[model samples]
Target chain A: MGETRLMKGNEAIAEAAIRAGCDAYFGYPITPQSEIIEYLASQEPHKRTGMVLLQAESELGAINMVYGAAGTGKKAMTSSSSPGISLMQEGLSYMAGSELPCLVVNIVRGGPGLGTIQPSQADYFQATKGGGHGDYKLIVLAPASVQEMSDFVPLAFDLAFKYRNPVMILSDGVIGQMMEKVELFDQMPRATEFDQTWVTTGKTADRERNIHSSLDLDPARFEKHNHHLQEKYKKIIENEVRFEKIQCDDADYVLVAYGSSSRICQKTQKLAREKGIKAGLLRPITLFPFPYEEIEKLANHVKGFLAVELSAGQMVEDVELAVGKKTRIEFYGRIGGMIPTPTEILTVLEEKYLGG
Target chain B: MNEEIIIAGFGGQGILSMGSILSYSGIIENREVSWMPSYGPEMRGGTANVTVILSSERISSPIINTYDTAILLNQQSLDKFENSVRPGGLLLYDTNGITRHPERTDISIYQVEAAAEAGKMASTKTFNMIVLGAYLKIKPLVKFENVITGLKKTLPERHHHLIPLNEEGLKRGMEIVKEVQLG
Candidate 1:
């Protein structure tokens, strides 16, 4: 309801989390995404409304702290770039196994290891196909704007608790480093109400409570727990797949991309018009739950599709699977801090549609 | 039809606040907007910039490579961006800082002696507002009255005294644009 104001994407997410009644922020600093930690450090959340903001020794420690806070049903989050997110995977899997609800933001950077300071969407497979090990899924929301960066916090929390799962706001260096005006809502009061019947908040009065690790001796109980998680994931897939389409109402080519890469595709759509090519864009807002159904529908209309990204052909695999080889799907990218220019994207469009 | 722009320069030249006011004007018009900034290691006398996207649609991607408009406050920014601007795009430059004329024939370039004009106003930093005023004049995307109202709404509650001076700076900017356009 308020007017927008200039804010860095990292700072905006930090403010949004606090406003959304986050009980704790546990994080370590990492390049391109370190501002989130820096902002929290400056705000000194302990002095303001009892939010515990801790600069952990490592990303590993930070995510485990999130697990502890979330175990008590207190809303909590942690954030880092690719390397840090990689470090936190063990804890993320642990949280998933224990059925703890929390939020994790990965402001992705180019990497197989310490790749560069610039933005890249190479984490697509890591995020969607399971960043962490074992049979589990992280609900990932890819925000392309600073405004959406602020807006996704509450929605992510709602989804996190709705399914008793972790939600990942998968962004990149571009989204984090970029500056934009954001309309910030007044901080809402924390929700203390939930199915406390399952949590361990000191086991107050009526009965003692227990929280345990996912290591089970009995195969039947383990299999049952896995089945329950599988059922939850299935429901998430059925109920939560989300994406956006532009200028695709009647188009022969649909360009599939997400996060920062999708923004480039939007510009490509405009240029494609000038070239007399009917092109559209399919941008996935949620990485997991993948929005397979929508992509399938787009496949029916567009003659060919290309997945453009900062990395070489990561998300293209998903496009091929969704659209099924019926259409020609190719990819174009630049790695290691090299941002793909709009002209480069136009060239790709020309090649695919104009047969150049 | 709100316009989104990025005003980029070295940190000392007031690039941050330049983008800030444009975003402020958009808000006063009751339009949706976002002003995202890059002020990190580059803040200590290195290049800094902010991307302001003001839109009527439910905006998705805030990052833009093809700017509808741009305000280049320094040479580095001009060299970096002058070639990248879209055809028919608007380029507003600081004549006092950038010596080279952009060779592009596709866009309208408005060269203003912003720093010099602001020096006359007794504040070099106010040059940003001058460029902002020029932005308002060329596009008139938001009304002057609304922009003034937005300025009042946006200024910190404690800095009320600076409001009058900022208004003067804005007025100076608009007047200069009119003079340049007429000549």
Candidate 2:
């Protein structure tokens, strides 16, 4: 519906940030994701859209800058790879505790520490189960394509502000580095609408001064704040569970995957179907409020569920929980930046579940 | 037809750009396309490669194990991707820097002396265009006119004046390409 261009996922997200009316971007360069900041820097968004772009001294500085900008009701964001994201955990936790709205992009690479720059979904647990130290969740949206890489920017920004919570676009190096045809949305004018109640734009005579701090000395008050946050999380889980079911109606077994793994699983489904195996794919677009219910519903009819990921079965635990003891749940993953072929995944499924 | 190709060569040989051209041409034709490069550390001191997929329908995975075609530019590429091409699929290569030639009998092998062709045009930068022209000559996945348009779109404005030279190299490549072996 818009101008179609062959663009890399990183470049598309950068341009989408500008089009999304983002106020500022604070980030450090990291492999597989440096193109994001580089593309933003090349566009000169400051001149084009009055958007601020800064290469911070470190990921800590970058994420804290996002926290500060978000506190002032600015549409702010930051992006980094696995290691840099690890460094930003403290700031992320602080922002979540302070109830700020912003976007954080993690173009995941293989890692426990200093891992290879190749793509991996090892960050699934870190992203969904809380990378930071608390019972807080960053509404994580997993993009499976270059188009979604562009589309999720505005979507994450909207979700961030709507719930006054941080939203992360959890992607991997493969999706970030790959180029595909994407129809980018049209440009929008930037406006600082001070309509939100919690944002501390400025103190004025007509309004009471708003306090912005995550620290609560009283335990009861902090517990009350956490209760409110949990209620918000419940609302998000109820409303924002987005996923795609491919050929599930007649499926004998289902492949549940997200992000890059899901894309590969789509092909695996085709291969399995060609081999007379009724395999389907379930792709979760929202990894935070994951398609747990959908997987549960599919398990009611499908005899087996395969949890395919780039990690050693991190999301498989969630799959097990969804399927329960009634259905068999198997997991197949390739770690340390090595990706499994479609056939390899299919073979794993056939051996694990079908007793091949 | 869905063309899943991998172009492999050392850096600065336009392997990534070759894939980009294929992708841009697919976009112009309103076909689904994806271009994925080898950004891993192997690209630091070794060969660089890119996987390109063009399809009439949606392309599910951008990165895959096998390829419909492998346009190799050097010995390392040929060694790496020779067996990766599907049986009866195309394997185009340049005879410039290749030491050991392809030994694959399961795939159709073709040769294009891209460096020699680009030498005639007095610019090694036109090398990739030559290989691209040779590939298109065999497959014609995208029309030649659309490729011209794609070249215009892919090249920056500063390099626009070199289009005619690239065009010449392309035509020379199309003329000189030889079918070495059939599957």
Candidate 3:
């Protein structure tokens, strides 16, 4: 337990990173997410925790800085919106290939190209299935509230280090801009000592020099590395399937949603239950190691499942893949920054399941 | 009880601040609250609005189309959100520069001459406090003491001196608010 204060999600993420003993924050400003960097800059984390806070010229530059810092075994992070995150995909791929642990936050906004600054969950496929060119995955945590926005920062870093992989806090503009009560934790000192066997921190007399690069020219070596990466991802999927089920014990109909859409679905579940329709919500907290097993188990008993999102059927594909042909899985979404209301979701449920 | 309110006005009219203060008041009263403002280009001199939700339990959604209360500070907000208030809900408007009056008969409409009072007090900055005062007089969702405490928490130490003036403006607003008789 800590001091509770009403704070914005973006600001909370910044403060949480500082409290989590992050070594550095390098980010470029973007709509719906600029607050993260702005808050960090204002707090002067350099003064408070001897952390390095630099404003990079571009998202590419910021992510590269993170890759450089993480290569030295330092806890580093960068945040941006969708288009900006797209710019960092190449860098992210390099980091994943090099097995670097770092945190990247995407406070998502609607986009195909430089889209609106309103909230959206359109980056589901881009985040989970690997936006970069590789057989790799980032541990993606989708936070639905300001509290989770704060809580997930440390969790993302812990997991990123635990698996030696990049982690992403997949939030949206709604959560980034919204203000809610959050209990902030006490400050933890930055990790001064960690296993630096693989870190490039200048070779010692007794140790062999370590080189950090993803450029494996030998085909067999690259294939072995890919297999190793696949093994790690398999371990992550087996060990890190996190989700929250609300009223799902005897649900006749279930709604699969995440991030801000999950909050709306929670309300829709209550509205449906009030009308005698048994609706439940399964919110995937970990989007990468998605709760496929839970969804599959639920599919056996539930009559149907509706995948609701702030995008045109993105996560619905994952839901379909998870449940297979056990039950009917439908998708209802609003794209281009348009959020579907609870009433709209309820109406869809009625039209699809209940006799209107 | 849950109160989902939309406070809309011009960018410089402290629309967002009012919502923030209301949310802080909810915290003071030990209630769950959320304050979400419309950001980006619209916040630059254009109409700005914030959705403030206060509930005894955890608030699920911060964004909602309909509202239990619509506090319109200008004609644009009145025209935009007048119909969004739920039936038997409250629509409080400051009779400042509103040209088109709200015509919703299903909801309770109240007018507060907050702008005129603020002008008389010679400080346009206190205008939002007056409007907030009117909302409190009508709904009384949070205690007046909690509102004052919320004001202290929201204001910086350098601006703490203005609290008395805001308190005066709030009292003036409470006195000037009048319920409209819908035919």
In candidate 2, list every pair of residues with a backbone clash: none
- CAPRI-wise, candidate 1 is acceptable
What does candidate 2's lDDT look like per residue over A1-356, in tens digits? 78999998999999999999999999999998999999998899999989999999999999999999999889999999999999998888888888899999999999999999999999988889988998899999999999999999999988998888999999999899999999999987675443577778888888899887889999999999999999999999999999999999899999999988999999999999999999999998998898889888888898898889999889899888887887888888999998888888889989987788
lDDT of 2 at B121: 75
Candidate 2 Cα misplacement greater than 4 A, ranges: A192-194, B41-43
Quality of model 2 by C-alpha lDDT: 0.90
**Better candidate by DockQ, 1 or 3:** 3
DockQ values for all predictions? 0.32, 0.80, 0.82
Q: Each candidate: what lDDT?
A: 0.81, 0.90, 0.92
Ranking by DockQ: 3, 2, 1
How many angstroms is residue A95 displaced in model 3 relative to the true structure, after the best TM-score fit? 0.4
Model 3 whole-model lDDT (C-alpha atoms) = 0.92
lDDT string for model 3 (B1-183, tens) is 899999998898888888888899898788999998988734557889999999999888787889999999889889999989999999999877877788878989999988888888968899999999899999999988888888898887899999999888778778889999878
What TM-score does candidate 2 reach? 0.97
